[model samples]
Target: MTVYPTRLTQLSLLALVVVSMVLSLTSAPTMAGQTYSYTLPQQAYSQSRARDYQVYVPDNLTTPAAMVMALHGCKQSNADVLADWGLTAAADQYGFVLVAPFISSYDGLRNENCWGFWFDHHRHQGRGEVEDLHQIGLAVEDAFAIDPERRYITGLSSGGAMAVVAATAHNEYWAAAAAASGLPYGEDAASVSLTGQCPGSASFHSVSQVASDMAAELDDDYPIPLMVLQNANDCTVLQTAANNIRDGHLQVFGSDGSSQGNSEASSTACSPYYQDRHQCQHTRYTENGQAGQRSLVETIFLDGPLATPNLQDTDHGHYWIGGEHGNNGKWSVRVGPSYPDIVWDFFDRHPKNGSTSGFPVITLIGNNPMTVNLGEPFTDPGATAEDSEDGQLSVTADCSDVDTTTVGDYFCTYSATDSADNNTTRERTVTVVDPNTPIETCEQATASPDTHIATGRAYAGGTSNLRAYASGDNIDIGGSFDTWSQVTLHEGVPGSWYSSEPAACGDDSNPGDTVCTDWQDTNLNHSLAGRAYYAGGYFSYGGDDYLGAVAGLSSWVRETAPGHYQSGQCP
Candidate 1:
């Protein structure tokens, strides 16, 4: 169901938090000694579940600029996110626009108004919560400049789950995504309660299953670079469920399990936001075949308690952790002191690699309706893909089943992917046909009755192959000289001769129709009967009598001339 905000949009006077790129890269997020507020319009865009949101611009770069959206966890407000998280801090340091959005109240939720993560929910693409958030993005674009290449989104807890969905479903919009303490593909987020006491319940799945399912959901051609922020000491969210954020992305990127690419423990002198020494770990993964070539996904693990005591009025529950506390008061801070600086450094490195757009587009090139002659060689025109960012893409066509050697409709398909992770596809079809066969000339003379045939070709001038007029399929209705099944030599006849199903011969009209009965029932004709045997061959309009049942077949009595009767018996 589409989520509709309970209240209509209301216009308000502008209050924008402005930041400067001139600020030190290693410093924490700050207002940089200036604040400007712009009045948001009554509405940004229409959505069933639309709601109010706030935006902070670091600097108004008239050219396209980057935009980062953050979603809060349960019982958390847009205001709370802006105050506690380092996204705003980074927005100031990097001169990017920061967006804060709200979610609806979840049913049976442990925290009030938490983001919803039901198993049945449609969490991909422009549906559900992502749709609601996208409208807010459109509003931000309309209000300020947004670099199409640098758009990014991240979230915490339940919001973290939402972030992954938004990125996976609509990868074209986000160049990269960072999910802090959330499950990818929404696994294990749904529960009877918010607490982590019963994580092993059947309602949740194993790390491998979660990783596999989430990986299967992603499009290989459009994998958005991801950073999974996890805490080593998080007690509220189990380490297994949380780690899939990184594992799932690696699986999607075709990684075989993984190994740590970077790690730092007990590093001091890291930030202005923290007085305590910082501890951090960075794990990186690359695509399977391209290992040591390009890193596709990474995870940052920090164990921390907020170094800046009383940064917020409340306690540090499930918050970023630093050096371990004696009471273990809160989970380790996966995103430690000066989180924005470290996070931004990673984001800055992975921009859109292919086209400026999301995925590649493909086009099939060939005759709209193609044709191939019987026994002729055919080559498919195939397809090609073009990406604005990645340029021309690699295409592969599958034509293993195409049989131009025989007459039939054959389908050939092509697929392609660009470096930027976009994909496109196209297909073409070729119809095989034989213009004529040797069966239409019914010029056989009436042979002497009861004459034993010596040679097989004596009956029809040695040209026994005839296309069945009733079914249009080639059938061996004559003697050893006939080989219609091999080359469709009987196409001269109007109607198809044989059945597509070889079993149709079992239903052949008994007696005279028993000769040459092993015809394919392509036309589904079950009434092929009445033809007599020539040269002792048992042909079928549809008969199963195989071992040369020539007794009732020699009686072909169709009279061609007024005075002479054509005989089924060969003399």
Candidate 2:
């Protein structure tokens, strides 16, 4: 008889996880790899209670491979857990690290080998099971180079319950976690005793009740992706347990315009598991992060009509059992699905920064090996940067001492650091050259003197009756040279015409006291009448009351000569 799934009712709120994979591989013989055990550095399981787990390292283990911490149900060993998931060949083919941690088997009467999934002692923080698992994952990180965004956790039964608890409490440490046949966490929630057999009579709390408890424990803003796998006819852990898990996830992951569209998945077979008459349907809900990237939460339903205690473990399918009709397993319970591919595909899409390396890239622009003329302006060509986490980044530049005015080579550096502290830089060389030929001579300018016609002579006293000197004679204003002082002193001669002022009268014959000798006018006119003036006039020897006999309606003018000024600079 096949058990059909009851229609799920709409719950108020909950959660999201990774995208599915499409890779198809044949289920080859289980090539058992080397499984090694690791001991906890510090005592976490229980004081004095030794804690250790085993990991299967494939022969072809590559750098930065994805890791999955597969947890086993009660009475299951690490090897059994790995075998149960049917991931040995898949791990080899997909190139991932498969880790199966056997829950520390305590000597206690109650806390034996089973994970303390639903217990008051394990619910809260501080020296507890959840903290221990987180530390172990961190330890695993230290031991391997697994991608932070590719690290995940999945389990069966109580181990499944622990997966849910660990993922929610410590979302920062994991990329995603899928709990197969698990229960909602919290001390108040209903639970079953691991000491008993499969399908114990334990009543599960309502989905809302579980959601309320989770809402209190988990941060409302913490939206990590979750994938819940439910077995419809599960009696070992009832179908309602899976429903509660799904509803709680949906509630915690609010649809407050923060999340993206939903994707529904259905497949006849994925690999070794689903091939043999098993059915699978998946629903993936995602949210666009502030960077417009993807964060997801997915839930898968694996159930179909099968008899009670179905020899294939079909009815109480407490495992992720599906495959592409390989129909290859020692027992009906062992053979099933292509879970690894679905998981890998999902993890591939969601990194801390949208399938990116969580870093920024800096690109340089403008002239490289730039050649510029001396004295010419050389502007720095800048750079740009981008980061998936921080989006488009701001950049700054530094030119390595390039003198555009002087001829030389220089380097310009462009750099930027994203918000995530990812640094990027680029450099360019700039060469400045003086390409113009040199010049020898430059232009020159000079000035020459012109004739100065005196306005009149500046005299010591009045000169009356001296040819009736006009009012214009002997007048000085505005500091203008009163007398005809602007005269051409012939190369060696004192003056042919000097201002007749007392001290400057070259007409006098006083030795060393302003005297003149052999002086001639512009027309070779020389007067020896004790004192000579221009226009053929003469002032008497002693007291020339005529004030040196005014010049002929005196007037003055100036002239200049051509110059020889040089180019580049005035010479």
- The candidate that wins on lDDT is 2
Q: Residue-wise lDDT of candidate 1 within 178-223, one digit each (tens)?
A: 7776665756444222444332222456556766666555554566
Sliding window of 10 residues with minimal summed lDDT for model 2:
558-567
TM-score of each: 0.48, 0.49
Worst 10 residues of 1 by lDDT: 449-458
By TM-score, who's the top model here?
2
CA error at residue 454 for candidate 2, angstroms: 99
In TM-score terms, candidate 1 sits at: 0.48
Q: Please list the Cα RMSD from the true structure of every candidate, rounded to 1 decimal place.
A: 32.5, 43.8
Question: After superposition, which runs of candidate 1 have C-alpha atoms over 4 Å from their true positions?
Answer: 1-47, 60-62, 104-110, 190-203, 255-273, 288-294, 305-317, 321-335, 354-571
* Native-to-model Cα distance after best TM-score fit, residue 310 in candidate 1, in Å: 5.1
